[model samples]
Target chain A: MTAKLAERPAGADLVRSGIRAQAANSSFAFVVRAAAVSVFVILVLIVVTMTREAWPAFWHSGLGFVTGTDWSPSADLYGALPFVYGTMVSSLMALVLALPVSIGIALFINEYAPRRLRAPGVYLVDLLAAIPSVVYGLWGVLVLGPFLLPYVQKVADTIGTWPVFSAVFGGPVGLKSMFLAALILTIMIVPIITSITREVFDTVPADQKAAAVALGATRWEMVRGAVFPHSRNGMVAAVLLGLGRAMGETIAVALVIGSTAQITTRIFAPADSMAAVIANTFGESSGVNRAALIGLGVVLFAMTIVVNMAGQFVARRSGRKGAGT
Target chain B: MTVPAALHVPPTEAPPTALATEGLGVYYGDWLAVDDITLQVPRHHITAFIGPSGCGKSTLLRCFNRMNDLIAGARVVGRVTYGDVDLYDDRIDPVQVRRRIGMVFQRPNPFPKSVYDNVAYGLRVHAMTEDLDDRVEDALRRAALWDDVKGALKKSALALSGGQQQRLCIARTIAVEPDIVLMDEPCSALDPIATGRIEDLMQELRRDYTILIVTHNMQQAARASDYAAFLTTEVDGDGDRRRGKLVEFAATNELFTHPQDPRTENYITGRFG
Candidate 1:
């Protein structure tokens, strides 16, 4: 009927206007699809690049790259043990220190914080995340380093007899160590964890809270029994995402870490991580040294992919199960 | 409908007992939702608070347990006395008040736990018992859900049907052993079968607890509540939306048979909201 009417002279304008409206909607849909594709492509490209570099360490070095501990690039002896230990220890430190603070901050924003304060609290947390990696490094060097030194030195001197402390607390506070890197990483990742956790916590339905409240559960009880349990998987994912951030950080770790290739966790002792090693050595070294560091980069790159893939795999599987249920 | 010729005298004059509101008012920021409602939710019976949408029936229920305080701007005024204690007293805690006066919301929001866990949630919240298993079993039995859900006590509460879920919520509330249970449109989203089950459950449970239910269904109000408070709101003489008067409160049989107020008649007859 529309085709028959459009054939007539009188129907030409209406058909043209209808076509224009349809075209507008069609264009809007096309833009949305294009944006989605771009995001997908960017993610795929990052994965491909990381894997392309990573495949060498996995293919050539194989189990040795993962299992071996010594890392000496000076005379062509390269083992990933210390960097792996440093990465694990630092990330673990970051997570343990940041987890409670991040969760607390998220809860405050989601529940206890006043209505007027909620949005601003969120903004402040985001601003923490927005600060550049170099600024964090500079801030640690100029401010946090001196502040942490005295207490760290005292603790190291006090606990030097303990096995763990004996290994880590040998140096004074100014020297780079796993603890300092971990502390810096903790401060860096708190905002990221809090922001993501807060978002996920916010998505928990109001009705659920109200229901728990009606059941005579206190605010803390409601969070513990309902909100936390419901959003636990997402919260874990948020923490893992923060761990990923802590592992990959370069300038901040480089600035405070004393840049020694050792697995020592002493807060006062100097030590280095994979990212810190690569950052400090990249510009100065050449030939096999750079390739070894590149090889370490290959290792670091591989480790993060596995970590993030594990994180996102858990996130997606849980998301699918949650959505299905 | 007029006050019956035989039952001509007022009803609330029995005594100043049960629930009494003295010059009560409520505010949220600059907005006043409840305008000085002085009422006595009768003891040993169900009281229905029936009003149009946003007439503050639900708001009034929240006030009893200080649930309104959860809202950032909400404030309570005047006095609400339960037995001898003033609920709004400066030293009083909302948690204590809420524990005594449990509430069930419109939607059935069971905690995403096993049926047993959902029932035991309140007991654990109140820290009333260390042995939660027996307590959970007893509460479910009281809510008339023990038989149906008994076999699969380990099943998630979400697996229950909408009606069963609501009853599970009731079981959850009752587990804490509150004196008064306030239900905010508890059956609005339920099917007739579910609604009937809840209505019957209320009748069986009312011997030990006072219940206040806010309902949209007039028939439900007539069926469930022994005493009814018909609330209404209108653009008042001050040109602001003033909460309508309490109109009247009476025995269920008398209120429905011969309602004294024209507004009640119109509302009951479906002539207008």
Candidate 2:
């Protein structure tokens, strides 16, 4: 049939080649579509399996799982409030501690760093990201906790007088506490946020930067007028990415967070995160307790999804303004 | 209509030179891009630099406002003077030099901000905030963009058509009320009709501001300038190093009709660049 098509007139040659091309294209597309669909299938399967395993705990606990703090397996009491509190507070604490420093480092690497230092600065930031989270946990336990104790105590002494600060920083500052976990999380997430922010700042149009300078804007003002506004969406997305990482982190947080089932106003107090509690106790847990741990994973997944949706919303809003020369 | 008095300076009594360079050369790291040349830009007149690609016309234009200082490894030798002040003096700030001499780039680069904010950016930067709305209005009117964009002042500057965006850039440049406006191929990215509008705007602008423009289009240099400078690239025998050298500096009509330099005549008559 191939030899006959080649022997045929030019019209048949065109039709034959067209059919052959179409066949190749459809086969390629079919392979690609299958690969793409597998990801969705795996995701759906995970969700279904988790939902099935978690349903019993959900039915037994009702709203109590969210608001209750007790986690005594012997008493058959399972509440998730302390873990939720730890996760939320530690993540927020990390964000608060890391946001300004990350932005400053990003700006320095992009705009203000001396020419010779820029490359090394970026490399050092990447090096920070490459360090294993377990190493960070070890450093938090051995080096950082000892090194920072005196300063943390000083801060606790100075600002502990204020009502708001007292509530957050009051109580015994310990080696393993919500504050320590948040500090460790800051170390882990800063590089992620800074690298993304630097890349976004780099994407600001060169002509726009020149425009601001040509209009007599000072360096800081030029960054404000051009770089920051242009990169705002990407910056938000970067911060949210860091937030997601901080929320899902397991081993480092488990080691530092002290894993307790009490909710307290003091951030210096020991607390438990959902991932930490699951990792620490899941091996020994059975029956409804294991199911409740799986349910906690579901909640963490939902929170990350909400964060990602907010990031997408911000990205789309700024995307409209991205249509520039 | 009044800027805060402390931040405003009355234009100096018509100095013979708005900006002038003596023995000026620019280098990017090891490469010498433009060689020593002296030229004077008369106040309130249009001086156009015409050259082919890689001829360093834009480099020379950037010298007026110290804009070349922004580029890494860029070095300017010799002196550039804005009236009596040497622009490269250690006491002089490039930011201040930029304020006195504004620039418009080849592409339309409005901030990702509202049209009003784009025009107001320079004002707010220099702290010339009093009656800022009137200043923005005056600038837009002067650039002949007010009517087209007045209704959409709050709209993002990036939302405008290319021509409108370019005009908005012009308004932003002029809003600072600089003494000299350096345009580096401002109309290169525009259609002929848009180019024509900019040419008309340039003529109107020249009545008040000293305008120095670098353009690749010979006709644009001839049609829109009072004086023209022609530059061409000189390659070494090894072809390793190329530098842009000025061939002719004369009144537009004289340079075009009469051949002071054979190279200028060839370039003007389409024989070579």
CA lDDT, candidate 1, residue B63: 85
Candidate 1 chain B: 10-residue stretch with minimal lDDT: B1-10
Best by lDDT: 2
- The alpha-carbon lDDT assigned to residue A224 of candidate 2 equals 90
Docking class of 1: medium
Number of backbone collisions per candidate: 4, 0
| Cα-based lDDT for every prediction | 0.80, 0.87
Per-prediction TM-score to the true structure, in the order listed: 0.89, 0.92
What is candidate 2's CA lDDT for residue B222? 75
Model 1 clash pairs are A69-A81, A168-A266, A176-A258, A176-A270
- Cα distance off (Å), candidate 2, residue B233: 1.7
| Proportion of the native interface contacts kept in model 2 | 0.73
How much TM-score does chain B earn in each model? 0.91, 0.93
